[model samples]
Target: MAESPFAWIDEQARARRRAGLVRTLRPRPADTPLLDLASNDYLGLARHPEITEAAARAARVWGGGATGSRLVTGSTELHAELERELAEFCGFESALVFSSGYAANLAAVTALAPHGSLIVSDAGNHASLIDGCRLARGATQVVAHADPEAVRKALGTHSGPAVVVSDTVFSVDGDAAPLTGLAGVCRESGAGLVVDDAHGLGVLGEGGRGAPHAAGLAGAADVVATVTLSKSFGSQGGAVLGPARVIEHLVNAARTFIFDTGLAPAAAGAALAALRLLRREPERAARARAVATELHTRLTAEGLEAVRPDAAVVSVRAPSPEQAVRWAADCREAGLAVGCFRPPSVPDGISRLRLTARADLTGGQIDRAVRVISEARR
Candidate 1:
């Protein structure tokens, strides 16, 4: 005869159910017959033999986990090698690897935006960047999505140290940010530009250098980039790429980097293998982009409202949240796996079926996926 301490959580769950916003997890098996368009494996390297083999080799050579923080006993030869190669490949002066992309974002944002600084962030930035802005000591001003003029205005209002943050390619709509324009504005205002290329690496630029490289902003003294190894490299870690001084600053000041353990050796080795593979086969990047364009063209031709993809993600509008969930289920039933986006996930409150184009997806697979999606549309 005692009231539950978590009674409020039950009420919130009931509210979510009534609003059709309740979410649940569905674990996937190692091998499935369904065609996948839901995962972020844009380069289709997650299951590559070389990548996996490297991971296993690393685990054997360097043990399972990082024993301590990077400053303590966590740094390893593999991490150093990955950082050096990643920086060189991405055209940066230096790079620092982190345990995860979220932590990398946090480190970059918090380390760069010191106290009394101003942080101008894009309205449509990823959650990690948003959380970074929230945790940073600087004041945050969210500008319109992909708007350089708004960023300029925001920077103009501030007189001291300022940094503009955004995603290179938005994950939700798959639209690219105006990197050149944002960079120009930042230069004009003497502000630093920080971009999260989580969705751009291995899907844009020559040989998948990234959106910043594509925009000619790579290695700029005032520019910084954060990338995830999990999506494109089929590994599990994140890195911050910028000038050596900035990286050094992060090593000293970024709590996420200084206090957190170094990236696992397995992830570092896998990412290194994937990066070398990408360098050898540069066409993979172009292939992924081509697949995205093809998916968008075919989806629109089939009369579905799909956004024009700038990278490997293709988003198709859905009528409602419930309908979106049902439509995704229907696609699964048809032997296709797709992503479903709804209310809180989509800033605009529009539901969607989000499809990720992979470099390894064949034309036949594309056709089949399109057909399944078309038939499953509500």
Candidate 2:
């Protein structure tokens, strides 16, 4: 019995290293010049001059960080304004912002599912959602990926308060869930449907209102949605949106929202600016989807096993995890930075090279990226 209680950590680390799964943070320089296809800034707004400027101004005006927990001193007019605009933009009755999309998912899943409730989750959801399910108080049934029938069957077995949780668009494969079908299944079971629209907002629907809006479930009393500002808003936060009553419940009951510091003023300001920009120039959202489609088409034509995108993400299968990692490394060497997804990021036990399509990419950039990717395959 070691007093430190950390003696086994080294063994696990060595095991992870041998498995080629040890992850480390690499500090990126401001002037690093790799062509990015890995970042989630689908709208290409993360480094936009206006967005950065707004962030700078906010930090100067409101200080460098949120001073306290949102329930205490962290809530500000900026947060309130962003919440209002986000809810209205996405057609929800109310919205509550959290520190990150991960936190938002945790809050939503835990707050909505009570001790005796049931949670029906999709197998292909993001890791955050999967973790949220694990943290939830209710018993969770992981249904098959995007199978409404599976959802129905799971709900049939449970006769309590149930919630069907899924990502609007599967992150790894970039394939969309049958939201309409899932909603119908939930409707029959008297269950609420909770969607993590991380890859949908600012990349789906008219003006990127999100998949919930596209499926006509945005303001539905039985539906709740979560979104991330880091992806399309080019900011750093997440939100949960739903009926006013649901939001009220989250405000009081969601531990993440009440205990964590409010999203920084700079992020809130930048996200607000981006949202307004998107409202004014809605084509950014459409362009992102178009880029994703074109990338998939070109990759498939070049004899790659790329998944046809449902949003701004494009995933091409690789032979193995090591090969996938090497392929991505080669791409980086070729001045093209792309994402490499391996187990357990991919729930299907398949590895992939994940490419994010930026709305701002040019024709030449697309061609170059395609060439680089094709050449890097094992």
Would you list the C-alpha lDDT of every candidate in the order shown?
A: 0.95, 0.93
Q: Candidate 2 residues 1-378, lDDT tens each?
A: 556678789899998778777676778889878999999999999999999999999899998898988989898889999999999999999999999999999999999999999999998988888888998899999989999999999999998999999999988989999999999999998999999999999999889999999999989999999999999999999999999999999989988988899899999999999999999989999999999999999999999999999999999998887788889889999999999988878898899999999999999999999999998874
Clashes of each: 0, 0
Give the clashing residue pairs of candidate 1, or none. none
What TM-score fits each model? 0.99, 0.97
lDDT of 1 by residue, 1-378 (tens): 899898899989999898778999898999999998999999999999999999999999999998999999999999999999999999999999999999999999999998999999999989899999999999999999999999999999999999999999999999999999999999998999999999999989989999999999999999999999999898999999999999999999999999998888999999999999999999999999999999999999999999999999999999888899899999999999999999888888999999999999999999999999998884
Give the Cα RMSD of candidate 1.
0.9
Error (Å) of candidate 1 at residue 151 is: 0.9
lDDT of 1 at 371: 93
